[model samples]
Target: MFDWNDIRFFLELCRKGRLTEVAKALKVDHTTVSRRILSLEKQLDAKLFESTTRGYVLTQAGERLLPHAEAMESASATIQDHVGGENRNLTGVVRLGVPEGFGSQFLSKDMPSFQALHPEIELEFVANDRFVSLSKREADLSITLERPRSGRLISKKLTDYSLRLYASRDYLAKHPPIKTVEDLKDHNFISYIDELVPDPQMLYLSEFVASPNVTLKSSSIVFQFQATVAGAGISIMHCFVADEHPDLVCLLPEEIEVNRTFWLNTPEDIHDLARIKAVTQFLTELVDRQKKKLLGVLE
Candidate 1:
C-alpha cells in the first residue's frame, strides 16, 4: 500500500527539481518534503533520486513511478471534477502567471468579478515579464506572449493585440515634427533592457528604430507605459493599454503596427482539475468578451 500523500510530494519534487521549491508549492517545509521522499523510498526499498550539488536527479525507480503517479493525479482530478459537477464552490489555489501589462492593466481590473463568483477558490497571481514554468509548477495557469513549444502542456490562443509607437502629449509638443519612421531616430526612446528581456519577441524597438537612443529601460511594461506617459520618452506601447490613457498619443497606427497574440497555457496533468477548468473557462469567456479591446477594435 502506498500513501497517496507521499506520492503527491514525489510528483511535486519530480516537477520542481528542488526540495525548497517543492515545499513552497505544496505549502510544506523543506524538511517535510525530505522526510516524505525518504519515507516513500524506504517503503519501496529503492533509491528514487540521486542527491547532488546541482539538485535531485531521478533514479530509474523514480522515472518508472512518474507515469503511474501522473495517471493517479489525472484520475484524482477527474474524480474531483465529476464529484464537484463543475460547481462554483470548487476550492483550491490556482496560481496564474501573466505578462506584466496584461496582469496589471487588464486582468487585475477584471479579477474582482472572478473573486466574487468563486469565493472558495483562492487566487495566486504572479505578474511578471519572465516565462513561468508549468512543468516546474511555478504557475498552474499562464498567459504567454508566445505559444509554448514543448512540455506536457495544453494551450489556446487567447487574443490578438496590437502595439504601436507612443509618446506623451507634452513630449510630442516639445519635440520636432514627426512625419515618418525616420523622425523616431532623433527622439528619446524607452525600451526593455536587452539582457533582462524574458523573450526575444519582447525586443520590439529594433523593428522601428535601427539603433534607438534608449534613455530608459525597464522589466515592467507598465513602468515603461507610465514613463512614456510622464513624457520620459517614446515607447512601443500596447494599444489596449496606451489607448486607455488619454495623455499618451499613438504614433503611426497604420505604418508602425505590431501585432502579437496571447496564449493561455496549462500543464496537461492538472488541466482537467475542477479549479483549473473553472479558471480556464473564466479566462476564455473574459477574453472573448473583451476581444474588441484586446484587438484594438475599440477606440
Candidate 2:
C-alpha cells in the first residue's frame, strides 16, 4: 500500500513544481521530499514526473493521479475538521490574491486589524496584475477585477470603485491646453504596455483617447500612479489611490468616468472553512464601510 504522507508530498510538489518550495511548505528537508516522491513512484510502478534542468514537470502518470490526490486531500481536510476538531479554532493558512492597487493602497493598510483578530490564522498576501489560479490552489481566495467564468468557483461582487483621468498639476501647466476630450490626444500619456496588460479592461485610455501618445508604460498601477504624480504624463488612476495624492488632478469629471467592480473568488471545495469564511466576512464588511471612498464621493 502507498503511504498517504508520500501522496501529500506528491500533491505539494505538483502544485509548487519545485522540491525546495514543497519542502519549505511542508517544513521538511528537500532530501526528504525527493525520497518520498521516489518511494511513491516505486510503489505506483510509474514515473510520475520528468526531472528536467528547468524544474520537475508532471508526466502523464502524474497528471492522471493529480485529481485523485487532490480529492483525497480535500476529504482528509474535511475529516480532520470533524474528527480532530480543527474546526473549533479558526487556524490555518489562507492565501489571498489581490490586484496591485487594492492590495497595496487599500488592503495592506487594513491587514493589521484582521491579523490582530485572528492571530492564529497565518495569511499570505499575493499582489500582482496577473490572475492567480484558484483551481491549482495558488491562492485560497482572490480579488479579481473580472468575474471568472470557468472552474468550480464561488464569486461575489466585492464593491464598485471608480477611476478617472489624472495628471500632475506641473505637467498640465507645461502641456498644451486641455479643454475637451479632443485635446487629450496630443497630451503625453502613461499607460500599461499593450502586450503586458493581462485584461483588456486595464486599457482605460482607449475609452477616451483613440490613439494615446503613451510616454511611459508600466505593468504596475502603483508605478504608473507615482509617475503621473512625478509629472511624467497623464494617466487613468483609481480614485481611492489617486485622491489621497495632492499633486494629481482629476480631469473632466463630467466627461471621463469609469466604474469597475472587484469580485471576491474562492474555490467551492474549501469555501466553507472557518478561516476562509472569516476573511471573506472581514473583506465584505471592510469594503462596505469604505463604500463612499471607493465610489470617489468623499474627500
Candidate 3:
C-alpha cells in the first residue's frame, strides 16, 4: 500500500508546481520534500513524476492518483486542525463583529467579564450594520440578525428578540395614542433609511406608514432609540435594550411588536481550533443566560 503522507507531499508539489515553493510554504527543507516524493513512487511501485526543467511533471500513474490523493489530504487536514487545537490555551487576537446597537447594549457590558476570564486573549470589535465577509477573514466571529447566505461560514441561531414601539412618556402624551399600526401614519416615524432591507417587522409596518416617511434616518438602532427618547418621533427597538432606559415607554404595549433574530457565526472550517472552540462555547453560554431578556420583552 502507498504511504498517504508521501502522497500528500506529492500532491502539494503538484499543486504548487514547484518543489521549492512547496517547501517554503510548508516550512520544510527542499530536499525533504523531494525525498518524500521519491519515497512515494518507490512504495507504490510506480513512476509517479518526472523531473523537468520547469519543475516536476506528473507521470501517467501520478495523474491517475492525483484526485484521490488531494481528497485524502483535505480530509486529514480538516481532522487535524480540529483535534490539534484541543487542550491548547486560547491566546491571540480574536476579531469579532457586532451590530452597533448590540455592541453598545449587550456586548459592551460583558466585555470586561469575558476579558477577565480569558486574560491572555485580546478582543477586536468592529461594530456596524453591514455584514462582514467571513471568507475574507473580516472577522473571526460575527453576531448578526441575518442568517448568513454564505456557504463558507456556519451560523448558529442564538435567540429571537421582539422590537416594540417606544417614545418618551411626554411625547406619547402630547401625540395621539397609537393603538394600531395605521395610527403611526398620522404621527412621524424614525427608522433606518434603507427601505429595501427585508425586515419582517419593517414589512408589516408598511401598512402604517409610507416607506419614505422615515424623517429621522440612521443606520444605528441605538441612535434610532436615542431619537425616540428625545421626542424625535416613534421608533421600534429591541425590548431588552428599550427596557434598560427608564425614560422611554412603549408607545402601544400590545400592538407594536416585531420579532427579530440573533445569530452567532464562525468560519465553516474552524470547528477544530482550540481558541475558536473556547470562544464559541463562552459566547453560547453568555447568550443563553439572557434568554429571558432576549426572548421575553414586554411592557
Candidate 4:
C-alpha cells in the first residue's frame, strides 16, 4: 500500500504545481517533495504529472486520482476536527484570492481582528486583478467580481458596492466646475488601461464620458486612487475606500454611480472544512457590518 503521508505531498503538488512551493507549504525540502512523489508514483505504478514550461500539468492518471485524493483529505480533516479535538482550535492555512482594492484597502485593515479571534488559522491573501481557479486550488476561497457559472463550487453574493467619480479638492480648486456629465469631457482623468482591464464591470470610466481626457492609465485601482488623491485627475473609485480620504471628493455622485457585486466562492468539497468556514463567516460578517459604507450610503 502507498504511504498515506505521500498523498499529502501529491495533493500539495497538484495545488501549487511546483515542488519548491509544495515544499514550502509542507515544510520539507524540495528534493524531499520530489522523492515523495517518486515513491508514490512507483507504488501506484502511474505517471501523475507532466512538467512543461508552464509548470506541472497533471497527467490523465493524476486527474483521475484527484477527486479520490481530495475525498481522503476531506475525510482526514473531518477526523481531526472531531476525533482529534482540533475543532476547538481551528488551525490551517486558507489562501483567499481577492481583488486588489478589496483585499488591500478594505479587508486588510480588519485582518488583525480576525487573527486575534482565530489565532491558529493562517490566512494568506492573493490580492490581484486576475481570476484565480478554485478547481486548480489557486486559492481555498475567493472573492470575485462575478458568480462563477460552472465549477464544483458554491457561490453567494457577498455584497453590492458602489463606485463614483472622485477628484481631489486641489484639482477641483484648479479646474472648471463640473455640474453635469458633459462637463467631465474637458477635465483630466485617471483610469485603468482600456486594453488591460480584466472584466467588463471594471470599465467604469466609459459609462459617464464617451471621450475622457485620460492623463494616466494603470492596471491597479490603488494606483489610480493615489493619482486621483494627488490631484492628478478624476477617477471612479470605490466609495468605501475614497470616502476614507477626506481630501478626495466624490463628484456628481447621483449622476455618475456605478454598482458592482462581490461573490464569495469555495469548492463544494472543502466548503465545510472548519478553516474555510471560519474565513467565509468572517467575510460575510465583515461585508454585512460595512453595508452602509460599501453601498455609499452617506451617514
Candidate 3: C-alpha RMSD after superposition: 8.7
Clashing residue pair totals per candidate (backbone < 3 A): 0, 0, 1, 0
lDDT of 3: 0.74
- Cα lDDT of model 2 by residue, 251-293, tens digit: 9888999999999999888788777899999999999999988
Q: What's the lDDT for residue 20 in model 4?
A: 93
Which of the numbered candidates is closest to the native, going by highest lDDT?
4
lDDT against the true structure, per candidate, is: 0.88, 0.90, 0.74, 0.91
Please identify which of the two predictions, 2 or 3, would achieve the higher TM-score against the true structure. Answer: 2
Q: Where does candidate 2 clash, by residue pair?
A: none
Q: For model 1, name the residue pairs that clash.
A: none
| lDDT tens per residue, model 3, 94-162 | 788887777788878888888788887888888865677664456778888788886567788977777
Q: What ranges in model 2 sit over 4 Å off?
A: 82-89
Could you tell me the lDDT of residue 277 within candidate 1?
88
Per-prediction TM-score, please? 0.91, 0.92, 0.66, 0.93
- Kindly report which residue stretches of model 1 are placed more than 4 angstroms away from their true locations once superposed: 18-30, 84-88
Candidates in order: C-alpha RMSD to true structure: 2.2, 2.1, 8.7, 1.8
* Candidate 4 lDDT score at position 163: 95
**lDDT tens readout by residue for model 4, 1-299:** 99999999999999888999999988999999999999999999999999987778899999998989988987887777657864368887999999999999999999999999899999989996778988877888999999999998999999999999899999999999999988987899998888899887798888889988888999999899899999999999999999989999999988999999999999987888888899999999999999999998999
lDDT of 1 by residue, 137-242 (tens): 6789999998988988999998888888899999999999788988888999999989989989888989878989999999889889889999999999888898
Give Cα distance to truth, residue 274, candidate 4, Å.
2.2
